[model samples]
Target: MLEEVKNYKLKHKNLKLIPITTKNYWEIGWLELKKEQEEFVGDNFKSMAYAYATVMEGKYAKAFGIYDGDESIGFLLIGHNSYSFEGCPKTLMHSYDLWRIMIDKDYQNIGYGKDAVKLAIDYILTFPDGEEDIITTSYVEGNECAKHIYESFGFKPNGDNYEDEITLVLKVK
Candidate 1:
């Protein structure tokens, strides 16, 4: 499920990926966030809805949205989680649990998904001191497209599975 990382261009003529700020919250909420969650995650939509609501409530530190010009094409939320690497002590840090990620259905086949992920990696790698970082994400077993994208970014199984979800991780040195 790995492919060479490439600078893929977005299909939308004037697409731009940007961080979500307070000013754009209501717009994002109305346009992207309020849409029926089932359109994005099938039966898991309820959980996804709750996740978005949590983020909106400030339960997460940061949330980003990928916009096609002024319209939201996709969005992602990242938050801190406690973790330890192979016998290390638990530390308070950021981990990309990828609570939710969605791209407009019309924009699915385009490179926006991959580009959005690259943007995420670039943003996460910017932590000061070049400290090691880890990103964790999960996808339903049959979502081949997503599995490919995550694997292409070097994420591997973490030996944990919840129902049909398989968790994967990438550690950046």
Candidate 2:
């Protein structure tokens, strides 16, 4: 857990991962989906437009907003090709692709991104009595910072690539 996420209680100063709903979709889609962020993740990845159309409209993915207290600072999407167009790692039963996770430039560092990733993994762990499961994600080549962060959570490069991005996986037990 990140030091910033003090607790889960409603009144506490904690990071939250909320499902994106119709009421807040448009606002969130445009808030953190900036040009630089898009280019950084490579061509195959999409931020706002792709995420909303696929996850919100097409059911290709599921999305959550990263909030600090009451403010939205980032976004996350989980899915795979089997579920829709965006495919994650191949799994025997079920798994999460961790398709997209980003913290707005303004909110970079200060543990928001780290805790958000941890929260995402925590969400995955709750699957079916918290049995061990696979969660896969990819990062654009040269983004060692991301590799480090995800690795800190036990994600490891398995010699796979999503498009040109290096693929990594975590097995939650």
lDDT of 1 by residue, 63-141 (tens): 6667877777776655555233454223223465655566766567778778777766666666522344676777777
TM-score of each: 0.66, 0.73
Clashes of 2: 4
RMSD values for the candidates in order, in angstroms, are 5.9, 5.3
Top lDDT hit = 2
Off by over 4 Å in 1: 1-15, 30-60, 82-94, 128-132
Q: Which residue pairs collide, candidate 2?
A: 80-87, 80-88, 81-86, 81-87
Please report how far candidate 2 places residue 63 from its true position, in Å: 0.3
On TM-score, the candidate that comes out on top is: 2
lDDT of 2 at 117: 80
Residue range with the least summed lDDT across 10 consecutive positions in model 2: 3-12
Q: Which residue runs does candidate 2 get wrong by more than 4 Å? A: 1-13, 33-37, 42-60, 80-94, 128-132
